[model samples]
Target: MANTSNKVREFQRKLYLRSKQEPDQAFYSLYDKICRFDILWDAFYLCKANKGAAGVDGVRFEDLNSIETSGKLIKTLRAELVEGRYRPLPVKRVQIPKDNGKTRNLGIPSIRDRIVQMACTLVLSPVFEPHFHCNSYGYRPKRSAQDAVICINGYLKQGYQQVYDADLSKFFDTIPHSRLLDKVRSKVTDRAVLRLIKLFLKAPISEPTAKGKSRIVGNPIGTPQGGVISPLLANIYLNDFCRKIATKTPCKIISYADDFVILSKTPFNSAQQDWIKNELEQEGLKLNEDKTHIVDMTQVGNEFDFLGFTFKYIVGFIQHTNYVKIYPSKKSQKKYKDKLRSIVKHRTSLTLDQLVERVNRVVRGWKNYFGKVGYPRQVFFKMDWFLVARFYRWSRSRSQRRSLYLAQDAWNKLHKAGLVYLQPTKMKTAKVSR
Candidate 1:
């Protein structure tokens, strides 16, 4: 099983290198690669492993349980692709609330569609991954948000004393379909593959109504955020932007999907910033002027936040020597703490065991993510402190008003319930570098 799992997808690797070498050449008949049984087989497992909710079609992973059943489904999809009979279903539309009191729209594709998308992305990623700029780090294999943060740090330490934060307004929703399709056509000339992709691109939406019925509506632009291929498609759409900023711009640029931050030796004034905005607009992208700005890092006490980490300078205690400091941004910390608070405060009706289990899951995941960079140990200490107080209050609320030893009793009760929290430390913080 281990060997089977570890086996390389050789066709993908070879094609990856081939596309890397000849990025401009459009090769026809590449659709057959995605239709390979092995590729679909791997994609089936990937889709199963993800275990997401059923899409607009209501076909769940459990519906395709065994090897034979899963194989049949894959073979059916392969046949549909080979014979040019595949039809994409309109994705299920869902809305998620944002931190800024707005809701972000997501489209959930069917399970079978997800498998196809996965298979396509697995084969297609190799073809496009090599051409993507090093600075573009979202949704790519191996690279991560930490790598993007590391990039900014590298540029900052190398005397890039200015920061330009570029916010693309409604980036995913505003992508020009014709332009994106043209970009894809430049290299991916296979009619079948292109057709399948276009089918997805033009997929309408199945939006659920208040009466539990769903309505089908046209989606004229943008990829659905929740679909498996959305991120890859987003990267493809902005591939030019990545190449342009990384090559043409004088400033150092690091991006995660639509979030671009420019590091420069000289600060960009309003005129230069507007010029940059015009250039991006020419590429069919627009900036959110409200959230976009530049910061001159050479000046004392100037800093910026990127990818949940704050890039600023610290004054050393012994010699007053100054150096760059990277830590979990305050916004990130507050959001994490609020999540923790919500779990305990709202769920106090549950048993201590149940509440602690829920809380522990969040605490562990948060620590693992924020612990990647910076001295967040102090931050961890504060979180644990905050948790203790919240738990103590929760414990107090559960007890009798007649209890004489409230503090000690609550402490003892919390200990007995086996609640988990971070252990504060002064040791060296874990760091990730590219």
Candidate 2:
């Protein structure tokens, strides 16, 4: 462990220093570095440790959990790469239900391919991290949604009047492979690395054909959402985009991958919006017209939603002073409330203690995601109240229930039953250096 960890750190340090010293300097040799036994092992553990479904190849983590089997697999993978016989297979396609009654498409890579991707990312990430947008907080190391929210909160406090809510339609699916490779070539001149990336980019999709027969079809142009390297690749593709906005626009932008909103004192006019649209189209992307809008903060009743939270100016009746506050959007709240109701309803067969345990698990997860937002006290309290009401009402109606518990009694009973209750918390402003 010590030897492997030290090698990984040293390799990353070298890549960072070299890339930093000569930003545009291209290297023709990186394949060997990426394929090193130590680096591949490090990358292997990275994939094995994280939970994911098997790819189209149907290989799961349990199949390769043993150190002996995993080591042999890595060796075989390295040999294939060295012999130039490596080819990534078509990705498995799956859809997940979104909150808006839609589905999000995810493509799963084979376990072997995932290891190679992780290996490549482990070597290339340090070289590329220095060049990505500082304010872009999605999917990067040491950045989180909380950091992005804090940035927006600070900007609003500084009196940014208008929020330009921008949404890229099918961002990941529409990125032009040619353009992305060109961007990659600007700094990464390694032929082997480029070839591997191109193969990954054009990897076909295994999808249902006629009569639902599964077959590999269509050369996908964008990064697969489930690939280990997709986030970094996406950031690399969008780095130039951030620069363009800085150079050409009057607004300051903060982006979390595809979801980005620009803050400015003045609203973007028709011409400016058209320019942005044209810029996106030239890159094989388009703006989502339905989701794009300019939020005027100066207006009394106007609010705009960004990154799952709705930002609005609230005026107190006593002091009559306006201040900026944000909370989970109404859509998000409703979805969560429905989720809680469904959980309690679906766990009808479980004992009270078992049901409470399941609910607490979800409550903790929900709190982790939404609890840190600005001015979430009232929202958190309301959510707790809603959960309590739903659970107790359902409990009292149960035929096997012992006693009819009052509201306060129900709270105490649930507490005694090990139910985890969410408490109101003030949002902490996190500072990130540019």
Local distance difference test scores for all models: 0.79, 0.81
Clashing pairs in 2: none
How far in Å is the alpha carbon of 145 misplaced in model 1? 0.6
lDDT by residue for model 1 (143-241), tens: 889888877878888988788887888888888788888888887888888888888888889998999888999989888888888888898888787
lDDT by residue for model 2 over 211-328, one digit each (tens)?
A: 8778888765788888898888888888887878877776777889888888887777888888878877877888889889888887877898876787878785768688777888
Model 1 collision count: 0
* Regions of model 2 farther than 4 Å from truth: 1-6, 209-212, 317-320, 400-413, 424-434
The per-residue C-alpha lDDT of model 2 at residue 385 equals 70
What TM-score would you give candidate 2 relative to the actual structure?
A: 0.90
True lDDT of residue 257, candidate 2: 82
